[model samples]
Target: MDAPGRARREARIATFVGLASLASAMGIGRFAFTPLFPLMQDSAGITLAQASWIASANYLGYLVGAVASYVAAVKAPLAARWGLVVVAASTLLTAFADTVARWVVLRLVAGAASAFVLIGASAWALALLARSQRLRWSGWVFAGVGVGICLAGLTALVVASVGASARWAWVGLGVLAAAVAALGWRAFATMDAAVRPARPRGLGALDAASWTLILCYGIFGFGYILPATFIPAVARAIVADPRVFAWAWPLFGFAAAVSTIAVSHLARHAKPGAAAGCSFIVMALGVFLPAVGTGLGTLCLSAICVGGSFMVATMACLQQAQRVAGDASGGLIAAMTAAFALGQAVGPLTVTAAAPLREAIARPSAVAAALLLVAGIALLWCEGRTARK
Candidate 1:
């Protein structure tokens, strides 16, 4: 192959590696618990409150990991390698966790690993692709999260059909994650050498627009997570049969994957803030659907809307931040990620605090909807202002 052909091949490899890393980190490590929550409650005698806490613990760890990515001097490749390993280990070990406390600790560790992998792998892959002038394929990297989600959801569906315990499901996910990590390990071998360390910056260094972006990202976190975390459980509550309800999460994942690619194409012409605002509006509608309409159709629509927009909104916001912040995008990205993590951590607690779990769903949904609307308005206003300037 010629030099250009080799560079393209390397770029494609990096994108695939980034995708697999995210699938292992976010899909298996961070979100596998969402689908399994109901199973743990049914088979393991775990309470809703305990499950909420477990989820919160994982989000908290995500926040810590986001912070650590900025402050720590760890190399991105090293972090991605270790993070993937830890995610596989933590996911595998969850099968052996007999108690809620054990699951919480394991989830916390998994969350941190996920954050490390996401931030590290994304940076490494994007840098490689940009250097190779293959930046257009960056969307393929983010699609991995949705693909992973789809795989996990499908695995859960199969496990549920087989009448296997959630333990077996976790084991299956762990094995799959390990395989992904091993395959992606070679892609990161030269990443650490290729990328230079980012210079540190103060919190106040970001301009007004960046701060607004961070706040909007936090709201995005709070807005989408309520549905993202509970959709499977909500579906289970509506339909007792696992086979029937299992489609919700995989549908959600499919929508997410498709939307990310679509939105990436749209973003070339449309303003990122406007695109993100539209996504937030759609997601808000999705979050409000289950509250008002309890039917299967409504649930499916809700899944499509929320899942479709969350990753797209994330890509838009991160891309916008990078464009605006230029060379100093690292600190801004970490700050936005930390804010997002904080929002995610708070979402589950709000649901748990509301009594009579079924009734409680509406309140959080309403709040999420309201937050998303506000965020959408804010982004639109920002876009308009930018246009006028």
Candidate 2:
């Protein structure tokens, strides 16, 4: 109720709201295409590989955007506020593009814009926190991805319920994203700013441990994304509820947010690698649940597992990299981000390869479950050994 306490509380709320809004716009909104891919492909008469390209194009743009923003020294605090506007506008434009080529270009632009918005907002959030509180605040801020994912999923359901066409869904998402952007703009505009300028640096500055961390992160990327990309489709296959398609993503997002917050606490007491390994174990269990259970509850549980582990491991890896690499945060962040994008790029192909097995196993969840379990085992081996040393 006091002045300083009230001020601090307000500041924290601003950061949380700003970060969450950015996540909804950039992290969740832009990436919704992955979950929506099957539906879009079916409606648009595109191939799976082509659908994959749409997703890839977005990430490719993200890489370019992140790099470009770093190089331009574009006043991140200022950029963060506006990036959401641009991203939202771009999301809306994606609705107008009719051809695949046009969609690709639009998505690419959207991706780049999203990167600027998210990275800028995140950097600002971290900078605002005291040094002692930075890591925990950053972890909480990162939970925006989960929140965004939930929003996107909820939107998808609403759009689907109206029996809207795929094109309409795209338009709806764009408009919704823009609306969220406006709210974000308002939230960050009047609040005190916290970001300071830092010049972009190259990855060569990263040490051996940093490189190891990046590689481990890449594995996490490859392992976790398969479920993220395919789980909705897998859910569609098992549960007959047309509504399941809409509900699946929100469920995933909700689970992801909860898991990120819960495991972040765990990260304080445990080795980061150990925490990551345990996360993967959970992911493996969640991804496979439906194949064995084939019920709606299984679908919800699977979402919980994948969503929770999705970013917890990512944050832990980044934190570990910062600790081990020291002052090489820029390079380590870049490497980890790049590896994650690459893992996501390869995820669909991995799922596609298991197509024949889907028929035999009677579920795609089975394949995803096996993949995550193997990934967890690898993470456990790495972490367990690292812990022993």
Candidate 3:
């Protein structure tokens, strides 16, 4: 192959490696707890609050890991590899813990480890790829999270179907994560040894506007995740056919894949603001349709729209943060990621909290969907202002 062809080929190969490993580390393991929540609650005999804390632990760990990994990447990409291995180990440990308390701790450890691996791999990719190609390539790399989500979701579907055998699902995910970690280690080693410039710490680029975006993104995180996590359960509650619930997640996975591609394409023409606005619009429609409409058809449509739009929104938010903050984009991205993590962590908990209201008025799922619509509107407004300015 010609030099250009060889470089392109190598970058593509490295990107796939980075994405798959990242999906295992960050996407599947970190978010898997959501779909497993109702199952784990039953199996572990835990209160909603306790289960919520376990979810929170993972997010808190992700926040810590993101910052730590950012620092570690500057010195060596191997830091990411170690982080992935640790997270995978923690995931396996979760399977051994019989008590809610122990599982929470394990999830925290897993979250931190996954964060370090994801942030480090992403930062390394950003630094290594040429500037002209970074945006699109980085989006593709980030798609690993979606890929992992699909895997975890599909696993949850299968495990949930087995009645009481769902514990094995956690073990399966841990093993999958570990395998991905091994693959990531090999890929990181193969890539050119390039070091990142020093990052100014202490929330480097965060400003008032950036903080607003973070809050908005947090809302998006919470809104998107509630549906993503519990759509299967919702399907079970509403659908006549129980098996239809099992299919919700795989559909979500497929939608996520499509959305990743769509968002990347949109980025080529529309600025981040336009992209965010478009995504939020789609998400709003998705959330409302399922809330007001009926049957599996609407449910699947909601999943497809929500899955695609939110993923794109996240990418657009990060892109906007990078554009607005320049050198400080790293910190801005980190903060937004933290916010996003916080939202996902809180989403299921919010559902549990709202459970009591189900008897009094509308269903909890409807309430959650309404909240998502509100968040989408907020995101659209924010993006519009950003574009105008």
Candidate 4:
């Protein structure tokens, strides 16, 4: 093959590796618990309060990991490898934990590992793609999260049908994560040596555009997480049959994956901020659906809207950050990610504190919708300011 062909091939391989790694890290490590929460409650007698705490613990760890990524000074590939391994181990260990405390600790560890995996893998993959002049592949790379979510949701559904416990479901997801990590291991083997480390930049280095991206990204986190975390539970509450409700999460994942790729293509011609702002508006509508329309159709539509737009919004914001920050995008990315993690950490806790378990669902959904609308307006304002400048 010619040089150009070889580069394209390599870029394709790297994109696939990034996708698999993301699936393992974000899909299985971070979100597998969401689908399994109801199962744990059904089989192990776990309470909503306990589940909310576990989710919060994971989000807290994600925040810590995102913050650490800015100053940790590790090579991206090395960090990714370590992150994948730890995520796999933590996921497997969760299956053996007998207490809620143990589960929380394991989830926290998983959350931290997932953050490292996402940040490291993204850095490594995007750098490689850019070097090969295949930067357009990034949307597909980001879509890996949705693919992973779909896989996990389907796996949980299958396991539940067999009357397996949540522990078995965790084990199954851990095995899948391990397999994906092993497949992507070679892609990162030379990444550290090939690329120089990024220089550290503080928050003070950010310009107006970067700050706007960060704040909006944080709001996106808070807005999408309530539905992302609770969609399965909400569906289950409406439909007693696991068979019927189990489809919600997979549908959510499918919408997420597809929407990201579509938005990615659109982003080539459109301004990233405008694309993101529109996505937020649509996502806000999705979040509001369940509050006003309680039927199964509304629930599924809500899942579609929220899942489809969240990752697209993420892709657009990150791309916008790269455009505005250029070489100093590393610190900006970390800061934005940390802000997002903080928002996620607050979502479930807000619900836990605000209402009784049975009545908690609608309030959080409403809050998420409101936050998303605010984020949309903020993004639009930033875009207008940039245009005027």
In the range 1-389, model 3's lDDT, one tens digit per residue, is: 89677767766866777678668776655777866765665576655567567877787777776666555434446757787788788888887888877887888888887766655676566555543254577667767777887888778777766775557878999899888887778777777636443364665445766877777777676666656665665665575343566677767766776677666765566677557756766876676665566677877898888877776776677667767776456556666667777766766665555453122112434655566566556656766776687
**Which TM-score value belongs to model 3?**
0.83
Per-model CA lDDT versus the true structure: 0.85, 0.65, 0.68, 0.84
Error of 3 at 10 (Å): 3.3
Model 1 residue runs over 4 Å out of place are 192-199
What is candidate 1's lDDT per residue for 110-136, written digit by digit as tens?
999998888778877877887798777
Candidate 4 lDDT over residue span 1-389, tens digit each:
99999888879887898888988998987898888988898888888788889998998889988888867756778778889998999999999998999999999999988988888888788877887988888889989999999999998899888888989999999999888778777778854425344446666877877888888889888888888888888888888788888888989989989988887776667777887898999999998887777778998999999999988898888778767876566667778889999999988887763554436868778888998999998897788788898
Ranking by TM-score: 1, 4, 3, 2
Report lDDT (Cα) of residue 167, candidate 3: 77
| Full ranking by lDDT | 1, 4, 3, 2
Encode model 2's per-residue lDDT on 149-230: one tens digit a residue: 8777776677666766667767777777777676777656765544444355556756666666667666665666655765
Deviation in Å, model 4, residue 47 alpha carbon: 0.8
